[model samples]
Target chain A: MRLTSWGNLSLDDYQTFFYDFNPNLLAKIPKPVIAVGASRSYGDVGLNHLGSNLLTTNLNRFINLDGNLVTAQAGINFAELEKVLNLHKLSLPVRPGTSYLTLGGAVANDIHGKNHHLQGSFGCHIKSMRIWRSDSGVIEISTQREPDLFFATIGGIGLTGLIIDVTFEATEFLGNQIKVENLVFSNLSEFNQINQSSQNYETSVSWVNISGKKNGNGIYSRGNTVPEFAKKITKAPISYPKNLKLNFINSTSIKIFNNLYQNLQKSIKISLVPAGKYYFPLDGVNNWNQVYGAKGFYQYQSVVPEKNAYEVTEEMLNLMKEEKTYSFLTVLKSFGDKSSGGLLSFPMAGLTFAIDLQNQGEATLKLMNQFDQIIQRAGGRVYLAKDARMSREFFESSYPNYEKFNSLRDPYFSSDLSRRLLGF
Target chain B: MSKILVIGSTSGIANEAIKIWLEQGNHIHLYARNHDKLKMQVADLEIRFPGHKIDAFTFEANNLSKTLDQISLDNFDIALITVGELKYSDELVGQIQVSEKLINSNIQIPLAFAQTILEKYKTQGYGKLGIIGSVAGDRGRGKNYLYGASKAFWETYLEGARQEIWKNKNISLSLIKPGPTNTAMVQGRELGNLRLAKPEAVAKVIVNGMERGKSVIYAPKIFQLIMFIFKIMPIKIFNRLSF
Candidate 1:
């Protein structure tokens, strides 16, 4: 088996099987240890396991679309998947923060898109899957054949078995561009009220420009839904990312980077845009991690319930301010809802703030540790996906119902991503 | 039937080995730099296997005195030191300070822990000790020879400590020399097609070697044979293929 990473990977150790296997042809190997998706599914949930040969690059064929039922190999990417779905005038229900995941990966991680509350998780729409169980060997499962494994496989972290191909129902899209409106929240609390007050919109997420400050802190959000008056355009739309550059700098660098960025943003006017443009604003700048420089960066994304938002975010911001750590990317989004079956699923009708911390040495860990304490006190758990390193105890303490999650996990079907983070 | 204390819980091998102890319903104490990541693990074990007691503590495992004091209450039957330094970038190749820290982190600190813990285990009349040594320790090669030197010293120290104490006292010490296990430590680094063992495979070998009362184990079994061949090769020829 061969192994290669996505440069330094979006996070780290994004293990993907570097083989090509056609469903038409049989295997000389065990289906790439278990195929890993586009790797956008944070954590090692999408990583290949030990002694397991993976088929990643080769399994990315997206062939044939029968109505809303799209059939794809394990490696078909989400961006391309979205493009195909849009071609059929449809969209996946829950889109995780990124659209780079494979259909198999999205199912494995059960990714939740921006409009989670209205739709539930990504697994809600999945009809069935063609799986190759290491123990039972290949079988097609849905709500019937091996239904326990199927339900468990939904957010199973790809542990139930290897997914060779997937077929899920898709939501129809209105037009190329969603009618988007920009709502700049002066603070987190304001974002909360506005987010809660509105629900009729098709999609909503707050883009927080949180820099560890009280005022002028929070998101520059964009909410969009299909409008009846919108004209249908035949041409495919393009999205330019706001740039996911978490610029790491000393005091000198911080001032220059923030000043230039803020000034540039002061002029961008409100307008309707493509759904991709509205959602993945930072997708344009390729290798956006370069902004953090050679030291690399840490993306800290945590979900805190609305009740604890004030106290928690206050302490969170206060701690970062005290630490004097500057990050170019800090986003606050009000989560919608989630399914009951999702064991370790994020968001319980709360606000999640994601920030990128450039490696500023021990200080970053200390601040995160401090953030961990506040989050723990305020009843919040850190997101396992974006986390490269976190104490196992803290992870367990936050996730008290892990016994429930662990019970669902197939003994042989443990995720490499969760295993590494937990050091198991 | 041994309740053990795994000092360096972050080791890939140690983590898998701990699972066996958990399965045996043995009380295992997990220690590492980060506590949150392991809470889910130890907690689940504690809850799932109610009889299996798992306690975790976050400490600078490199600090012998601090670790010894913190773990005083838990009189462990085994002390497995899996902490070591593995650096891939050339940024630390020649830097004496960096090398010194690596040696201290991998060798000196573990040495201190061994000296303190082994004395207690010896006095107690029974103990098992395993270290996650590497094939790099089998002999110095061009790549990461400094790390090899540290592991080599550890292997020698463990051998001496084992010999100094009478074998009949029921003390067992095993040096785990796994060739190159597929671990996060070697994720993106270049390790030129050596037979890399899996973490579980390494753990299984270590557990078996401990059960058989073997002193040193080359993980995956094949690496032992491979290293045996490498050990006797002439220095001139070995040096040619060092890297």
Candidate 2:
């Protein structure tokens, strides 16, 4: 079977096995396998390329929910979990950008969202998790018991073992409404100023118009869950046409889109929107990546230290313009001083910039390699969940805990990213 | 608030339908083969739909009769039988144990449960019964004749049962034939451009059809036309083609 991650970058054939929520079935899967849930990671982190890829979507079963804590299988995505939690007037402590992410995926990636400045990454909220390791069989790990392996497994990129289930704490659910305020920032420094002043907001992120002359000029939005309940609105996601042969996103179209988007937010706009609309706008369109065409697209997300953030991001944006690689979607956010617990977690106290570039084959790869050099120099690291082409040297240098995580990785578990970087 | 009985409740489509029914405030009694899995599912549902009445029982094919005797079926407003299995073999003579298991699981167990429930429905004077048949039952191909034969039996049984219960006026029986769906039963198979329907989508159609008192339903509705073409194909041409 052919398998790929959300980025649609590397569609390679794999020996796919579906998890049936049976422990015995795990023993039968061939060695060097990785358990993938939702395949929401926008890179080869979930792909094994000709090796075994254990599809864990079928393991999606909620085990229990007591008080403010909920336990569920690894394959239960946030969308399903949120529905159940909403019924109980509860919500997840850290809500990622998209609700389609499975609990295991969120932990493996240690994903951060608009609220990272306050709640930290997803791993911070995990109480405990059970993993099935080929070397030692199934075992439970938590902060107290096997603390090293527990942190290793979080943001461990599914290389530690196949996560079986996780118990996580839920946050208070005020309502489904979000009071969103959108402000315009003219430059990276201005964006940083606004981001610093908006610390009171629970969630803050910026959509940067990288194609424009003023680098990082775009709308900066801040949101907080409101007490007022919003009327439930269910919109069916529109899927991108599979047969479309050409990529419609180019320099000209991107400019038009940026202009149109800018026009919509020319004035400071304040509106009450649904939490889903505010948090997961991209999820409204299924397979939106297909619009990049058969060649797919690459997402380059990097977090730079706060001191070097402005200068480094300016240089990176200038480099993208120099290379004539106009990113269709560019996002910027700030992280607080909070550890993600996971050794390999991406977030740190810094400013993070993410952009999507069409897979221009060698050109995109070369440009990303250059971006890595600047990020590495600024003591920044590319997000593994969204990286498909980071160098082994860069990975080893960027993540100080790489060796520690490598020591704890399950010998029988491997992924395209691990095999490429760790040389397993 | 309706009392719904779902046999083989852990199956993908059945489980999804159970969720929908639970959301609609229906009290569900679930029965499955694996005790642990059944218990886990029931627990999951109990937490998801707090305050909803949910009861579960586990029984193997050989012990279904004994299990059925222990439980009462007098109050169920709806009963859905979603018990079936698919096993493929290339050999001319498949293993006897496999054949026996298929027959017992797909035919005997479901038939026994249906008969018991139908009797209770008849005595109680009103009920809706739904059995998940398959489009394969319309016309068996060389690929899945064993499974097809079992569902074909259901098509015949339900047709007769619908006529037999026609005078009851309040009683209804529906045979649901769903096309290839994205269930565990057909998850990893290579279908060559064939689109498998989502279990949730199929469940919605099944529950709607059962509520509307449809005697026969082809979920996705497209399956009705496809099955019609297969059901009337010339024998020679059909034999010459392979699916």
Candidate 3:
């Protein structure tokens, strides 16, 4: 079967095997097996070129849901988890941008969301996990027991082992709606000022227009949980549509869409929205990535320290303008001083900018390489979850702790990302 | 609330049917081969519908009779069977082995198990039993005779059983003949011109047919007409047509 990342880049042919919650099946599988859950990663991190992928979607099941802690098989996506949690009036401490990702996928990537400044990445909420190592038998790893392996498995990108079940803490919420307030920012400087002032809000994010016309113009939004006394909120029906055919997106159409979006932001300055609508806007459109066309697109995200964030972001935006290249979606968010624990985790105290540009083949690759150079000089690293073409030299330079993470990886567990970056 | 028993509970179509039944506040007893997966599914249902009662048992489809003997059929309102596999081979010897496995899984186990439930339901004078049949059974093909033969056997057996069960007016049976459905069992195989139905879509037809007391119905409704023409085609002309 053919497998591709969310970015629709790096297509690789691979055979997949399914396990029905049986651990012994691991021994029968070929060596160098990579476990795939949802394949939500935007790059080759989830694709194994040398061996088959063990699909964990069938292994989804809840082990337990006691009080605030929910223990479930790694195959269950947050959408299902959230459905159950809503009945108990609880929510995941750190919800990813999309709930389509399986629990194991979220852990492997140590995903972060709009509330990263307050809640940290997904790995922080993970209390323990049961892993099936290729050589070693099934064993439980947690912050206390086998801490090093547990830490490595969390953002280790499935290089550690197959995560069977995970136990994590859930936060209690009043309702599943957010009262949002949108503010328009003329430049990156004003966006930073608003972000600093809105420290009390539970969620904060901005969408910037990198095109030459709009330049730094964007919408900055902050939201908090809707209070109980507020008028009853209606949840929009959740639907997943089939991916649209190619040729759905082009540069001209995107420019018009961005302009319309900017204009709409001015009208909808304040409104109440469902949590799903606010947290996972992309989930509503299902296969929305196909809009980028058959060649797909690349999402380049990097986090630079607070001191150099402004200069680095300005230089990157200026480069895009100079090249007359524009990104369809430009997200700018701030990270807190939370420790992700995983050695290769991407979040840190800094300003992170994630931009999605349609793939123009070699030109797109060349532009990403140039962006990597700027990020490297700023002492920052690209997010592994969103990277499709980061160089090995830059990967090593960005993640200096690669040696430590590599030392703990399962001998037989590897991915295309590891093969390209670590020569595994 | 209806008391439903679903065999091969983890199969694609069965799972979807189970979800709809559970959503309607029915109490379900599930039986499948994978113990842990069934437990997870049961837990998921219990969480989603806390008011309804849900239980699960793990049993190999080939040995379903033995497992059914252990569980009492008393108080069950309906039983749905969705257990079978596709097997193929060009060599006669290999084909025989595949045929035997298919017969054991698709015909013997389901018939024996359903007979046991029907015997009990007949005495009680009120109950429903649904057996999943296949359109492939309408005619044997050079490509998948092994699988088609087993389904043909099951459909024939149900046709005979329906006559006896109808003697007791309150007892009901449904022979659900679903067309080519997109499922893991059919993965990689060329489905030819047959419209591939989604599992959920097929499940809806099965449940709705059971509610309407449909004895022998082709799922998707359109397949009924298609199969009507297919069944009338003379053997000489049918054998010449290739999927």
Please report the candidate that would top DockQ against the real structure.
2
lDDT of each: 0.65, 0.86, 0.81
Q: Candidate 3: misplaced stretches above 4 Å?
A: A29-31, A212-214, A229-248, B10-12, B32-41, B56-73, B83-103, B134-147, B165-171, B177-202, B215-243
- Residue runs of model 2 more than 4 Å from their true location after superposition: B65-73, B90-94, B186-195, B234-243
Ranking by lDDT: 2, 3, 1
Per-prediction DockQ comes to: 0.01, 0.39, 0.27
Model 3, span B1-243: residue lDDT tens: 898999888787888799889888888889888786677677766766666778888887645556767655466889998877877646345456667777887887777678788877877788888998788888788877777788888676777877776678777788888887655565433333345676778889999999878888688789999899989999999899966
What is the C-alpha local distance difference test score of candidate 2?
A: 0.86
Error of model 3, residue A390, in angstroms: 0.6
Compared with the true structure, the alpha-carbon lDDT of candidate 1 equals: 0.65
Q: Model 3 - which docking category?
A: acceptable
Clashing pairs in 2: none
Model 1, A30-143: lDDT tens per residue?
333445555454334445555343535335545445777766677767776776566556776667655566777777666666676577777878788887665556779888
Q: What is the fnat value (0 to 1) for candidate 3?
A: 0.18
